[model samples]
Target: MQNVTVKNRNWDIAAHMYFPEPFDQSKKYSAIVCVHPGSSVKEQTAGLYAEKLAQTGFITLAFDASFQGESGGVPRYLEDPATRVEDIRCAVDYLTTVTFVDENRIGVLGICAGGGYAANAALTERRIKVVGTVVATNAGRAFGELNPLQTLEAVSKQRTAEARGADAMITSWTPDSAEEAERAGLAEFDMLEAIDYYRTPRGSYPTSCNKLRFTSMSALITFDAFHYAERLLTQPLMVIVGDKVGAFGSYRDGFDLYNKAASSNKRIHVVHGASHYDLYDQPEATGQALEKLIPFYKENL
Candidate 1:
């Protein structure tokens, strides 16, 4: 594995590239682009999946989204869905330039919000031969449902404030601790685990700060990850979600994608007893997901 940088529109995306053992540049190989969840960095779950996929004989890349992690962008922690979708395409742009990479065989895997971005990107980025999503969350629907009118009003106020030179606001996915989550009436099983995974030693990393620009709420609330899937998303698709991810309606998003996709080749894999956060780093759950992913990419890409 090696750390690298790819130049996007106006940012430098930091990424980790994993090469298969005994890699030979003369022989072209299929490549997979792994996208991380919102407010998360590549070094966390994205890198884990990339490394695992590389062991299965595919060159894989996990990249930090623009304005987040090690990537270059203004107003750090901005979680713009459109830019996130384009980031996947930008990664493909880099992959196509590598002599050892087979341009015709490219796949994309997205986790959490990244899954939505991957699906959106595949709608038009025809270079993506296959699309896999792990515990995918439709950002627009998920966040919008959390009091849409109120949140939109709040975002409008924040935008006005920022325009008046006020400091940008920041929001977090997890509370500082599980106790805080419980006290705040957000102590759902998946919610608590999400906090533990990203905030505790279980999966915490310096760059995975779990922060997002408050101004991003507008895009987060309006961007549909699976927009136009019924017409444009014809690539082979696989949506994986844990049965225990009911707390956040993760399975609903996966099912919606499966039901709406126009792809003739599509499958939904449910990992029993695994919650949304468990799929992030749990070995047993992640292993089950990889079992499906390995074969899907092998046959498609």
Candidate 2:
């Protein structure tokens, strides 16, 4: 494994490049770009998957989105969907430049909200041959579900504040504590578990700060991750979501992507007994997911 920087427009994307064991530089290898979840850094689940994929003999990269984690951009912690999509394209641009990468066999894998960005990126980025998403969360739809009028009004106020020279307002992407999460109505078992995962010693990291610019809400509410799936998302696609996640409407976006994609080859794999957050780092559940992903990429990429 090596730390690398990928040049993406004005930002230098900080990433971890995982090379397969017994790697042979003389032989070309397929590569997968692993995208991290929103309110997440590349050091978490994205890196986990990238490392596992590399173990399967594919060169993989897990990168921080511009303005988040270690990547460079103005307005730190801003979560702009458009820029996130562009980051994936930039990762692809970097991958194509590597001499040992098989350009024709490049693939992409995204987790959580990153799944949405990956799907969006794959729509117009034809260089990506196959795409995979785990526990996909459509950010637009998720934010839109908040009290519509109140959310919009708040975002509008924040925009005004920013224009008037006020500092960028920052907000916690997730509750900072279990009590706060519960107070915010994240009382479900899975929801509580997710809070713990991001906020506690279980999975917390210095770079995974779980904060975002309040102004980002405006763009996030308007951006659709699967904007043109019916027409432009033609590549082979795989959607993996925990079966239990469907009960909470979290998996609906994944199913929607599978249903709307024009790809002749597309499928959804439901990991049994796993919840939305369980797929983030659970060994057994993640193992099951990779079981499907490995073969899917092998057959498609």
Candidate 3:
């Protein structure tokens, strides 16, 4: 039930800390650094998950990734896989120093796109003992050259140009603008259950820098968050996905790809009939996802 500022390498970020009712400063509680989906902030499903997890004798943190929402950074709303991964580590660093938190037992849970980034972050940051991804995505593979038509070579060339002093522009892939939603051309991409989830009053919240800078294409095209999947991650990990998601098959493949190299106990669970967004804020569905997570963290972290 508090808001604190975490200073990162880039800027000072704002985050809401939900302490369990009847707060006990004498008790060192376990914690979960809840990471939101791409283009999302603490007020969205990320906060919902953090609150639920906090209620179960765990301290949870829901934060806005840098350059988005309430967090700080210039050129706003850009998605840098490298810095986004650091945001998670920065949150963990902040958590470990806070009062009444058992830093050693702290873990993380990322929803949607955040899930993939969390997995990648855990690979290098051994400080995280237990990691969980909800409605996981292989952003790198999907956004990368996972499709032969979208060759990695083309993306790499763009990145190389940027590294050589080209302008930095990031483009947003979110459908958060009503006008943009109308033109989303859903016929082309039905992977999202509903366009409104990313647009309209249902979820869209507008801001000038809310979208990614087109220049970030350089970083994104060449940036594969799970670049080191086969190694680095040795902690207990959990992957939760909606059983009937439109992209369920892809998620399954991503899970299979990483599970092969994860050097620790791991699990994969499917929530029946729970589509992608359903796991985002659906009360019952999110509850189920957490139901699996609570036990997993209890045993692992």
| lDDT against the true structure, each candidate | 0.92, 0.90, 0.74
Candidate that scores best on TM-score: 1
How displaced is residue 98 in candidate 2, in Å?
0.5
Give the better candidate number (1 or 2) by lDDT. 1
The alpha-carbon lDDT assigned to residue 14 of candidate 3 equals 76
| Candidate 3 residue lDDT tens string, 86-196 | 999999999989989898888988887788788888888888888888886666555554354354455566667878987654555655444564576532232344455
Cα lDDT for residue 246, candidate 2 = 37
Model 1, C-alpha of 237: deviation from truth (Å)? 0.8
Residue 242 lDDT in candidate 3: 78
* Clash count of each predicted structure: 0, 0, 11
Clash count, predicted structure 3:
11
lDDT of each residue in 39-152, candidate 1, tens digit only: 789989988999999998999999999998899988798888888988999999999999999999999999998898999999999999999999999999988888888988
Best by lDDT: 1
Clashing pairs in 1: none
* Cα error of candidate 2 at position 293, Å: 0.2
- How well does model 3 score by local distance difference test? 0.74
User: At residue 78, what lDDT does model 2 achieve?
Assistant: 90
